[model samples]
Target: MQRIRLDAAAAANAEDAEVWRWFSGLLEERRVRWRYMFSRWVVNVDRVHVATEQNFYDAIRMAKEAATRRGLGLSTIGCSRIR
Candidate 1:
């Protein structure tokens, strides 16, 4: 029910700045925070990563890698920009 800033890394780089937008919400369990987001819709269901690393950089990297592994590539233009 609340929004929070969990990333403190500098956003000097364009990619770093873009990382913020891909993030949607936080899911917590056992006092731990996890990044949550909706993947590009595919088939009847979208494949999502619910337990990605909590750190922004790590989360982004993991997402990119996972997408690549699944044959769902994320392009430069696909990166989200912070509002």
Candidate 2:
């Protein structure tokens, strides 16, 4: 699995007020290893979202599994693949 990383301090200066990130590693059912760690600038809060998935469907599947194990659930799931 290849880990994709983005270093904020190394990024070039930009005038955009908001920065957004979008990621898609598999085009036809493959693995995507993702790692994320979030920290608040002025508050004591941390968040993380990471998973190694075989495809878009697998990502949703894994999330559902995790939720289910914790007695939680999801309302909906969506995809934008043109098949």
Clashing pairs in 1: none
User: What is the C-alpha lDDT profile of model 1 across 6-57, one tens digit per residue?
Assistant: 2323334556555444432111112113334454222110245422554555
lDDT of 2 by residue, 21-78 (tens): 1122121222223332242111010122333355544444454344445443322226
Instruction: Give lDDT: candidate 1, residue 9.
Output: 31
Off by over 4 Å in 1: 1-47, 74-83
Best model number under lDDT: 1
Stretches off by above 4 angstroms in model 2 are 1-51, 74-83
Measured with C-alpha atoms, the lDDT of residue 13 in candidate 2 is 26
